[model samples]
Each structure stands twice: as structure tokens, then as C-alpha cells.
Target: MEPSVFTRIVRGELPAAKVYEDEHTIAFMDAGQVNPGHVIVATKRQVETVMELDDELAAAVFRTAARVARAVDRAYQPEGITLLQANKPAGWQTVPHFHIHVLPRHEDDGVTLGWPRKNPTLEELSVLARRIEVKD
Candidate 1:
């Protein structure tokens, strides 16, 4: 399979405004910045989704994201911040690579994310939760 855009960036075959990197992850400014401090933190392994990552690699990705978020907060001092991670196309994941978007947010920034609430009852919620609850 061809490498995703992120893979090329990681391999130095493409240009990116890189901000942070480690053995397991790399972070860079997003080409289409929703905000001034918008950045993407991705796994170096080139996995397409978070489900493909083992616990350790997944944790590393979030660790780097948190680190970059702090830096972005300090540098940009936005009114708020958003950490977004999407899965498949249905989940709004345009790029196949697993990554997190650290977005510095402000009022009326034009970004909108909303979903209708189901408002299931307590018993109904419990039943649904039990269906997918993790078991050791």
C-alpha cells in the first residue's frame, strides 16, 4: 500500500512544520490550520486507526499530544483548547493515519461539532454499557 501523507512527512519525503517527535510519535503543524496553534500528533508506525495501536503506542500518542497542547496553550494562550481524534470516514477521519488534533479555540471560530442526544433512561444506559464493557 502507498504511504499516507503523514508517512511521507515522517520519512522526510514531504515537508511539514514539525513541532515535536519521539521514538513512537511525531507532531507537526496542520497544513489547514483551524486555529493558529492547530497541530497534529501521530504515531510513527503509520497505522490507519487508533484501534490498530497497542496500548503503549496509543498512550505515547496521547502523551505527545498533551505535551504539545501545553506548549500550544503557553504560546498561543487561546481561550480554550480542543483535542480531537477521529477513526474511519464515518467518524470524519480524512487522513487514514491515527493522529490527534490539538486545536486552540476561541469564541466564534466557525468550528462546529454537534450530535443529537439520545437521552436513554438509566436502565437503558446500563444495558447498553454492559454490552460493550471491558472485561479483564
Candidate 2:
């Protein structure tokens, strides 16, 4: 398989405005900034989706994201912040690598994310939850 765009960036095959990096993750400014402080924090291992990540790698990526979020807050001082992580194409994941978007939000930034509510009953929710509940 060809390398994902993020893999190319991490390997220095492409250019990115990198902000932070550690052993397991790397962060850089998003090419299409939703806001001034928009950034992307991705796993170094290029696992495509969050479900493919081992616990350690998953934790590392989120840790780096939070760290970057703090930096963005200090730098941009936006009224709000949003950390977004998506999965497959159906879930709005354009890039196939595991990454989180740190967005500095203002009152009317033109970004809108909305979904219809199902409003299932507690019994319905419990039934759905049981299908995927983790068991030790």
C-alpha cells in the first residue's frame, strides 16, 4: 500500500509546519486551518484508524493532542476549542491515518457539526450497549 499523506509528512517526504513530536506521535499545523490554531496530532505508526492502535500508542497520541491543545489555547486564546477524531470515510475521516484535529473556535467560524438525535430509551440503550461491551 502507498504511504498515507501523514506518513509522508512524518518521514520528511513532504513538508509540514510541525509543532510537536515525541516517540509515538507527531503534531503539525493543519494545511487547511479551520481556525488560526488548527493543528493535527497523529500517531507515528500510521495505523489508519484509532481501532488499529495499541493501548500505549492510543494513549500517547491523545496525550500529545492535549499538550498541543494547551499550547494552542495559550497562543490563540480562542473563545472555545474542539478536539476531533474521526474513523472511516463514513465517519468523516478524509485522511486514512489516525489523527486528531485541534481547532481553536470562535463565535461564528463557519464550521458546523451536527447529527440527528435518536433519543433511544434506557432499555434500548442498554440492549445496544451490551452488544459491544468489553468483558474481562
Candidate 3:
């Protein structure tokens, strides 16, 4: 597999404010942080999302993210933490690789994740759920 920005960081191909690294994933400080102690955890492989990842790889990445988040929490002591992983362009995935953003939340921080809520009727929900449940 070709190297990603994350893979490069793991291999020291690129310079990053890295905090954690393991065989499967790497966690680094986000240069453009929305809040203090913001971090990004990413896999060395190029899978774009959880659905694209095998179970073992996905578990590894998630575990790395959790560990990083715990440390960030202890270090920064933010009121909360937000873990975000978007898939594909339509879902606002900027990179073609998998990553989990660990955003430390603070009341004074300007970061906001807002979307207009749309509640579907029970019948609509049932139809959508059934359609999604039918795996190939």
C-alpha cells in the first residue's frame, strides 16, 4: 500500500506534532485546532471509512482513537470530546483515507457542529431501516 500523510508520519516521512503511534494507527495534534488539545487519529492504511475497513483494522483504529482521546482528556480536561468520522465527499470527508477527529470541547470554543434536524415518520423510518438492513 502507498503511504498516506498518516503513513508518512508513522514512517517519519513528514513532520507532525504527533502524540501517539502504534503498528496500525497514529494520533497527532491538529495544527489547525478548533480547541485546545485537538487531535486526529488515522490508520496507516488508506481505507476511507469504517465500512471500507476490515473488522480488525477498524477495531485497531478505534482503539487508538479511544486511547488518544483519553490522554487528551486528561491533559486538557475539556468539558467534552467529539469524535468525528465522515465518509466520502458527500459526507464531508476531505481525505480519501480514514481518520477520527478528537476535538476537545470548551464552552468558549467557537467550534460548532450543527445541522438541521429532519424527523421522518415511523413508516419512513421503517422503510429506510429495512432498506439499509438488506446487506449484499
Each prediction's RMSD to truth = 0.9, 1.0, 2.0
Full candidate order by TM-score, most accurate first: 1, 2, 3
Return the clash pairs for model 1, or none.
none
Which regions of candidate 1 are displaced past 4 Å?
Answer: none
**Candidates arranged by lDDT, highest first:** 1, 2, 3
* Model 2 misplaced stretches (Cα beyond 4 Å): none
The deviation in Å at residue 54 for candidate 1 is 0.3
Q: Which number leads on lDDT? A: 1
Ten residues in a row with the worst lDDT in model 3? 1-10
* Candidate 2 per-residue lDDT over residues 19-76, each given as its tens digit: 9999999999999998898999999888989888888998899999999999999999
- What are the lDDT scores of the predictions, listed in order? 0.95, 0.94, 0.85
Q: Flag the better candidate by lDDT, 2 or 3.
A: 2
lDDT-better candidate, 1 vs 3? 1
